[model samples]
Target: MVELRRSLSLVSTFLILFCTSTTAQPPAPRRSRTRAYIEVSCQITEYPDLCIRSLTAYIHGANATILSPRKLVHYALLASQHRAQHTRAFLLQVSKPLKAKKDQEYQAVKDCLEQIDMSVDQLSMSIKELRQLGREEATPSPSRDDVVWHISNMETWVGSALTDATTCLDEFPGGVRMSRMKATVKAKVLNVAQVTGNALSLFHHFVVRYRVPGSPKKP
Candidate 1:
């Protein structure tokens, strides 16, 4: 009887400790907040899937906590810049061989290269403006006008870049020899434009959300 009682007491003590330890731990924070950021922010854009895909990189890193509205604007700009750079690289590669031949395709490729170069520059400018916005945010009394102007500039530049991408695609000849190249180039340029367009939409939402006084900020 004594041995059985001792065993029962030990088991009761172990169960109590286990329950206490388990109860002491906090519940894991739901990722729904992070997902809400992607879902809500991407809704304004036509290319929600592309916007979500572009933002996936930032969502997983140590920097994940910085996925606020203002920072999302910065992330979107970076994604646009990255896509623009990739399209520019592709254009540069294809332009080289065609340039040597001086074929009719050379002019098309040359035009695209010029447009892509401009798009890259514009996206770069948008990124710089975002940096400026960050600086302004740290001020004691950041100028709302300054914030508005910078966000507007980002939208304008990104929008222009998207237009340039479309122009590059439209410039390609419908000839059989260039069909494969045209298809490839078109696909690449469209990807850049789609992401840029999505970024522009995100900027618009950021403007609306932050512009209002006493607006509830998202988590």
Candidate 2:
């Protein structure tokens, strides 16, 4: 009887351990929650599908609980910066084989390369500002004005990047509209512009929703 009672007690203990482990939320639930959060946040953009596609990978492993609104904006900007870098590289490839013709069409391609380069630089500055914003928020005592200031600067930089991307297509004369080269460049630049727009929109959304840690209303 003593041995039987000990065996029964061990079985009860094992059952308790199994139940405790099952009570905690598993990784699959965390991953789905994270994905859902990203999808909802991207709905604010004009190109929601594109926004989700670009951003989901950035926070793929992170749980939804840890992703603050500011972090969402940061990840969006990172996606924009990456898109701009890739577009710039593509522009360089497009420029190499073309002869330096004096025509407007050829010159537009040349101008686009410079424009994308500028966009890349602008995005780099914006990405740095995002990093600064993160550090500022993580402080023991963060200032409201400082956070607003950093966000404002980032907005301006991203806006400039969007303009730069669109201007690549603008330099072409009306007659050369959507020529083969221009069309090729347009496809790439348009991608950059859309992603930059997504980043800019995310900033606005985040700022509107952001509130001080203890404040009842948004700052």
Candidate 3:
């Protein structure tokens, strides 16, 4: 009888250990590559020029790519603004315990608000510079080569900003929060991509429309 009881106890111990191990394993990370791609495509089609402008702005402003410093900044600003606008909504959704000690959370939210303000200030400054450069390039009397050089410089600055933004996103730690932020940034970057493509298309169209009919196509 003693031996039998000991055996039963050992079996129970093993079962408990097995159950704990199995339950403790984290759930497999959710893969949403397809959904992400679709979201990116949708965002790209919405406003190509703004997308391009944002991309350029990010490059010139942050030395990053479309998604890195650029998109990250864009979404950060957006999320910050969103937080500010829905202060009451967020407070309502918190658990009772957290709500009871809301001051700490409010401080964090306030910091986020400050970050958004800084991003807006930086973006505004970048846009002003870009507009000035654009106007200079647009002057009717400038030589064709000079205009091209200015445009190329503008493009380079935009591309750099995009690179920076994407890099920042890549450095974020893996988790649900990062994934969600990534999705938001990707969506915004796609918009910038669409805008870039559209601007190029429109520029080409303008060239075609104004070309002297009898002039031979430039080689």
Model 1: pairs clashing at backbone N, Cα or C within 3 Å: none
Candidates 1 and 3 compared by TM-score, better number: 1
Candidate 2 regions with alpha-carbon error over 4 angstroms: 1-31, 59-66, 100-104, 172-177, 209-219
Instruction: Evaluate model 3: give its TM-score.
Output: 0.29
lDDT of 2: 0.77
Worst ten in a row by lDDT for model 2: 210-219
Quote the RMSD, in angstroms, for model 3: 18.5
Q: Candidate 2: give its CA RMSD in angstroms.
A: 8.4
CA-lDDT, candidates in order: 0.79, 0.77, 0.40
Q: Which numbered prediction scores highest in lDDT against the true structure?
A: 1
TM-scores, in order shown? 0.75, 0.73, 0.29
Ranking by TM-score: 1, 2, 3
RMSD of each: 6.0, 8.4, 18.5
Q: Model 2: per-residue lDDT, tens digit, 66-185?
A: 256667777787788888788778777766666444455556677888888888898889889978877887777777788878878888888998999888857754565476877767
